[model samples]
Target chain A: MNINLTLIGQSITFAVFVWFCMKFIWPHIVHALDVRRKAIADGLAAAERGKHEQELAAKRATETLHDSKVKAAEIIAQAEKRAVQIIEEAKATAKAEGDRQLAAAQAEIEQAAHRAREQLRSQVAALVLAGAEKVLRREVDAKAHADLLEAISKEI
Target chain B: MAGEAHTSAEYIKHHLQNLVYGQHPDGTWGLAHSAAEAKAMGFWAIHLDTLGMSVLLGVVFLYFFRKAAIRATSGVPGGLQNFVEWVVEFIDGSVKGSFTGRNPLVAPLALTIFIWIFLLNLMDLVPIDWIPGLMGALGLPYFKLVPTTDPNATFGMAIGVFILILYYSVKMKGVGGFFGELAFQPFGKWGMPANLLLEGVNLIAKPVSLALRLFGNLYAGEMIFILIALMFSGGAVMFLTGGVLQWAWAVFHVLIITLQAFIFMTLTIVYLDMAHQEHH
Candidate 1:
């Protein structure tokens, strides 16, 4: 083939194409790729962060559960202590009430025993007077004997 | 195009000749009908076939790419956009690997050279006689479809790269530095003539080899196809053999065309890279 002016025409066409491509085509596509790369990177980073936050929230929930458990144990311990104290106080009140009732009963029984002994002593004195009269075979002065009998009853 | 009356040599010559439009010996402007008349038109004539096919392919290349560029997104890509991006990425990767310079033009120029040359070379697989047969029916004198077969088009592109190489070498390293490189490289100033002779040839050979390698490969490939086509005009046995041989050569030619385009683009990037390197 002979070299001719076609070389220049082809050269002109070649230059125009390269110019058009450089001006219009390359930057947009490259920019799109760059942007897509950045988006993927950002998405991965966000996912990592979200995973970390989820772990933190789970930890916080467990910690709150532990705190509530400890608090519940303390409240139960206090309730058990208050119940024991109330039981002890009731025992003390019952013992005091029993002691007061026993004292009142004992005082009444003593008074009753004293009254019965006085009655028995008075009866015994009367029987001695009657036996002495039988031994003397005569009725003594009754009014003078009464005072002595009363004194003997008091001694008994 | 050759009629059915042409002999084998005439068919081969007809297929090899370009449809040139230029001045005749009478100083009149018209299309050349004969190869001798085309030669007489000399350096002023242009090959209309090469020019038209190249520009058409270039336009097709640009239109599709321009559409892709206009709709390119960081989002999900459509099929056309995906294909366009894939090709652009291939070019970009080659450039990034081969070129360390920060010039924006290198990548796009590489893209243009690769795709445009590949498209031109792809014309070789068009069955050798389709377009010319069509043009023959319409009464055109000559039609060489594959532009890479034309030395003018290959040199056109190669010389364009050569111009850029020369421009950048001078721009990056001042005129004095560039001249000094040619005059002092591979040997000291003591061997200035030898060094200049060596480096100058090295410099000029970049474009020459680039142009010739592509032109030679496709030219030879086209010549083989033309020869096989001549076989079709023989007996039925020759016609079947020609068909099989044509298919085989065309299948193998696909690799050659793609490789030549890749080589051309690679060499261009390398030469431009060399140009942008300062002499340390």
Candidate 2:
């Protein structure tokens, strides 16, 4: 169509479009973009913080592990010390018991020896008296017999 | 135009020109077109075009950020709250570097300007004929959906920025100061006649360049698409070949649109910065 009126309308319409865009429309889109940018930066910051936290946690875990190992070592050392003390105490007690047993055995041996010796001496004396009784006759004169016996005994 | 092909090109170009004021008898442009109609329509939908998308996106962001911002704590941040803060800070940095003084209104305004323009520019990535063809199939005759492709739209924005720069210049540097800048800044102190001529040219060039940059890029993009369409409309062989070419170009065009939007936003900052500078 050869209509110029449409062109006129279009020109007016376009100018208004520009005005609307500059005044109102542009700000909103910019705000959205601005939001996008901020989101990216925040994400980076959060990631950094997370990394730091993780590093800290790892450090704490290592320290705790080291502490536990040291404590275990200390406990083992203490047990070893206690074991040595117990062994020393047991050794002392055994030595003392052996000494007491040796003393008791010696005392029993001495008593037995004394009893045997006495019995032997008694037996000997009885035998000698019996021999004298057999040799002498009954109802003899005591003084005469005694003097004879003494003289014979001195000569032999 | 002897060839049918040449006639078609002419036809398309004719159709693409703005419906400014009134036309000549032979469908050429008249000397004095109505500025009132041009002023009114040029700024209307262009404003709505940017505003509509901005508000929608803003509401979505606000809803999401509100939830995030509320949940924010000094302890640890995750999910959406972290995301929102990241975006806010990034844009804050960009604005800080580009804009000198902290005007509460200007920062947010610049942010809006960037994103809205970005979204608008992104629309170019869609297949040139896709929406129009779909609408046609749905019984709608024609659709010129791209906002930036319209010169009126780009110029309108440029003009708006131009006005603001002028206002700020006047405010920052008084009337004498504003005039003094054009007279002596570009060239050293010369006679009044030469100074006046140079100043007038410099003064007019700002809005012209701003408007033309956006217009030229978008217009060129639109023309390429129209050319591709013409190829397909001719025959089946041309259609298939042109279709492949169109797809390839569309993919490549994504970078163009994004770059254009970024350039426009950055330029806006630069221009505003210039206005704020103290004259030597």
Candidate 3:
């Protein structure tokens, strides 16, 4: 490798190329790389934020579900309680109506029994007074006989 | 200046010369540190043509990044943004694999190295002489296009890394401790002479390997491009074939450039990680 024009040209060219690369090319490359790195970091941060928001929403939904379930159970229990109360009231009202009708029927039966008993007693007294007069074989006054019959009936 | 020896070839040679001032031998690589002739110093100075193109590409990339940054969305990403993200993830994964946790400097440094070197390598894929030729047409002289192709530039980078690695190794393990590790390693508690020799070999090899690997790949690529350009200059048929070949080579070169940059960055991380480790 003698010292020649070609070698000299190559050397000078190499130097110039290097200077250019260092001054212009390398800096841009570095800047681009830096930008890329920052973009990735930003993406990761955004993803993390989104994940956190998703978790928070899930937690809130669970809380709301629990509250709603409790509310539903409370409403059902109240309805059941109201239904039981209405049934008890209807039973009590039916019992009271039945008692009133039974008392009225008993009173009517008693009054009918009393009237029948009075009629029977009167007929029996008349018959007993007739039998006594016949057995004595003598005619008696109607008022006296009626009094004797009444006394006999009372004794019987 | 316009003598018989100072023909067009001489003029070309004069302009092609590195810009070194006084107290420097002629027909040698120019040294900016020495006070040389202003013309010699300028020859070695920055080639503005390639610099402008490289900077233009960089500006374009910057614009792209800014646009992507401003329009970045969480829901869906565009194609360009996706590509950018993929590159970052790829580099991050490689770094993560190479370096252990809590290596605060490793990731950032590795990232910088990867991006910077990747951009440098990508420049090789550009029409190798396109920038320089354009500059020549525009009345500019001594325009070089590729940087890593230069040994000075590659060595400069490798040496910087070499220093950093040494600093870290010493820092992680105290002065006596670091030296002790080398002596005791590989040979294991053997004779002092054998240990010293082996350790010396091991120590010298690290920086040399790093520098040479990069230099070899870049220099070879630059040479091939120059040869191909010379071939195309010969004939029209050769010119068409050269263009086709250049395109194919560029496609293949994409892999080489990207892979080399990745390897370099990965190796750096690995070396730093190893230095921190208690054992090899």
Candidate 4:
């Protein structure tokens, strides 16, 4: 019941205990807590950044796909246009070739017709001469009958 | 065996007395003395039982906590680690809530006070006769096991807190501000004397209340246990009732012990917080 030196002794003990706790015990625990908190925060931020980058990558991927599709369509369109031009050129060439061949055949036919007409005319004249010779006697004067022959040829 | 011829009053008196070490009335130093002899030794004497028990419990507190602290990890904790973390978090939260200014020492100081006092008070739950009986067998007559039951121990702790409060007040507010706080108050500078007297009492009352609250609760609880033990002598029916009463009281005293420790710790933080604050 009496206040005594025990108070001082216990106070010293209390002070020592407090000093121990303050110096050794408190800092480590609090630092651990702070470290854990920081770790969680950093992890969350990294996850968020990863998600954002993933989204951006996805968007870029889609854009690239669209660009490739458009490029492929353009290439196909160019190929189709080139194919149409080739077909048109081929048609024009074939038409020109056919016309040239027709012209040549026409010329050949014309030449042949001319030759046949000439031959027909020569044969008719020869036949007429022979007929005249058969009708007239052989002693008639040939040089004097030249004008008659020429007239006859002209008549024929 | 000593109770064979003595009255119940003497038994209770014997149980309440501490194993004191002090000077004799003949001016000789001795190991043990009567309570009256301890009083006559005049504030120079020590209660060997209280000091021993308190220091032992303090060591127990330090050892267990230090072990837990060493093994403490940032990862998922084991049962002991979890318990230690929970206690640390609890005290840290209490200091944070009650203490406004930031001092690295406050949280740990609060933790030490709470746990150390809790350990000291827990000795009360030991069957009141167990240690004394054992020590009595070892030829030691008187021993008080619970340190907080002694006014000296509680006052000792409270006085330590009181010193911290004064230190913080002077450190934070300066010496002039500290005195100014005591000298000026609810009435104004015109009532400086009244303010000084009132605030001085208020300041003194903090530690006094802290000490007495714990000491009174535990001492009363110890007395009741002694009384209950005394009840065992009144035959079979009395002994049975006393047994039931002891069980009931022990159960109730658990809350008292823990609550008193918490109150003491909280008040310490609050007082320190008050010192840290500057009120113009």
Candidate 5:
């Protein structure tokens, strides 16, 4: 076939079409793809950061759990030691109270015994003086015997 | 298509002719009813079928792409948009791979050449008679729907690329640098004439080969299709054979058309890349 005006016609059509494509189609489509690409990249980055932060939180939680456990053990040990010391102090107080009460009771009993003994000695001396006066009144002078009896009573 | 009414050679010749419009020697401008009249129309004649069909296909391609472009979104894509974006990405990748230049025009140019040429070549798969017979029934003398089979369309597009190549060459390298590339290449300055001969041929051969290669392949393929279609005029066995052969060739031609389009686009990018490259 002979080449004719169609060649020029087709060239003009092609130029116009390419101009339209460059202006409208190519930039819009490529820009959409680029935006989607950037969106995917940003989404992936945020996900990675979230994973890192979660790991940090997990590690912090474990460390805090370990610290709490140690503090709980320390508190338990202190409570046990305080309980032992309280028990020891109670035992010492009870023993001292018993000793002081025993000492006071012993002193009171000795005092009572001494008073009873003094009363008994006075009674016995009075009874012995009465008996000696009854026997010596029949045998000797009363005045000389009275002095001896008085000295014996004072000794008693 | 009453194939039996005409002789086999007449059928074949009829299918091969274009709907030409030009002035007659008698000073009237109209369609050529016969091959002799089409031939007599000479350089001023226009192949309306090739022009109309190619422009129609181009419009179809542009309409779908423009629809997709108007609503193109980064969030999600519909079926048409996905298909369009897929093709755009493929052409973009081809450009990025072969072209190292920064011209905004090159990629779109590659895309246009690829899709438009592909759309033009796709008409080869149409049953040889559908559109032409329809047009013939409508009182048109002849119609050839596939544009890539015409050298006019191919050379027209190739010349467009050639113009761009020349432009970027002068723009990237100076006009003198562009001439220097043609004058003193593959040999020293002492061999400038020989170098100009060799390099000039090389330079001009880019568009010529690009045009002829596509035109030749599609023309030959269209010719084979026409030849196979002739068997449909024979009796039942030949008709069945023709159908099977037509199917097989069409299936194979799918690869050919796609490959030709890809080659055209790739080579355009490469030639443009060469234009953009500065000499070390």
Candidate 6:
């Protein structure tokens, strides 16, 4: 173990190895570690963002569901009001038509009764004139007794 | 069987010696004839085994880690990617805890130091005689496989760290501030000379302790293994006792090697952190 040229050779070798390591090996390893750390951080941040977005979407879906339910209820209430109005209108129309038909029928019945009474009066007058002519055995002077005949007809 | 013709001391001495190449005292540039010859060659000599084994282990470390780096992903990791990420993260945690500076190089430097030293120390666990026996058969007379067991390799790493510490100190505080730090004190400027001596020793102690601590532990561990191997060569009775002892030592040595590597890496980070501090 004398101090010799081997010392110089080993020093040179040590210098070379240290230089190679500083230049090549060390940087790559350190960079890889840093890159991995960054990637993990980014992944964690993305996961947090995704969770927040999911929560927002769920909340929106619940709000939309509630809105649709309210709208459907409003639509159903309006439809019920329209149905009641239509039923009332139909009832009013039917009542008006029945009143008009009843009035017409009553007028027609009164006119028919009046026409039958007139016919009966005229037949009774002719029958009375024929009986008077037969009882008197001659033709009475009808032109001189016009007033009396009118009165007899009125009584009859 | 290799020690069959030699005494225990010779076996241990052979295992401790490195396959060195340098100028001989006879005015020839070649492999050293002996340990004494290798020492005599002085500063010019190279321990081929330490250099070769360390470089090979370093290359292996780089190749696998480079592959893992290429396949690294921001997503979940698997297999080699997982292992690489775990090691990087472990080193990064230690650096983050110990280091206060923002320099990009500290974490990677700590990682390289930890794993590279770990791989170097792991060579000790291999049966002491396996590779040396192989090299012996191939006509190489000596081989010391574990680089950390050699003072040169550990000191080499420590010196490199020391240079970086000095560079950072100068870069952060300028040359005057750097020297001021080395000269100023646990006492005031009135005690400048004492402060200089004390702080100077403190400054020098960082690298010295870093280097020696690792080298001492691993060298001692390697010596013990050599002793155990010597025991194995004694006889059948010694072989059984040696086998049990080697296994127990190796099991315990695992913690030592890992702890030494951790201590080395942590100290480096702490020293660099201290360099970055404006006042400490």
The 10-residue segment of model 3 chain A with minimum total lDDT is A1-10
**Candidate 2 local lDDT, residue B42:** 32
Tens digit of per-residue lDDT, candidate 1, span B189-259: 89999999999899999999999999999999999998888888788999999999999999999999999
Top model by TM-score, which number?
Answer: 5
TM-score of structure candidate 6: 0.86
Which residue runs does candidate 5 get wrong by more than 4 Å? A101-156
lDDT of 6 by residue, B123-235 (tens): 99999889998988898889999999999899999999999999999999999888888777677778889989999889999999999999999999999998888887678
> What tens-digit string does per-residue lDDT give for candidate 4 at A21-128?
888777777766666678889999999999999999999999999999999999999999999999999999999999999999999999999999878887888887
> Can you tell me the CAPRI class of model 5?
medium
Query: Regarding lDDT, does 1 or 5 come out ahead?
Result: 1
TM-score for all predictions?
A: 0.84, 0.54, 0.60, 0.80, 0.87, 0.86
Candidate 2 per-residue lDDT over residues A31-150, each given as its tens digit: 555565688789999999999999999999999999999999999999999999999999999999999988888888888888887776656555554465466657555566778655
Model 3 TM-score on a 0 to 1 scale: 0.60
Q: Which candidate is the best by lDDT?
A: 1
Model 3 achieves a DockQ score of 0.06
Model 3 residue B160 CA deviation (Å) reads 1.2
Each model's DockQ score: 0.66, 0.04, 0.06, 0.50, 0.58, 0.68
| lDDT tens per residue, model 3, A57-93 | 9999999999999999999999999999999988898
Native contacts kept (model 5): 0.76
lDDT tens per residue, model 2, B24-134: 344543322223333443322222222333345445544564565555554445766566556545556666788885455455445545554555666676666576556
Which residue window of length 10 is worst by lDDT in model 5 chain A?
A140-149
Q: Rank the candidates by TM-score, best first.
A: 5, 6, 1, 4, 3, 2
Query: What is the per-residue lDDT of model 3 for residues B1-280, given as tens digits with 9 covering 90 to 100?
Result: 2234445444334333332222223555433332234334433344333344435544555556456555555445689767656665676688778777455566545655566566776777766556655655775444455655545445545655666678888988888778887787666777667888887777667756765777678667766665565556547999898888887878887888777777777887787777776655
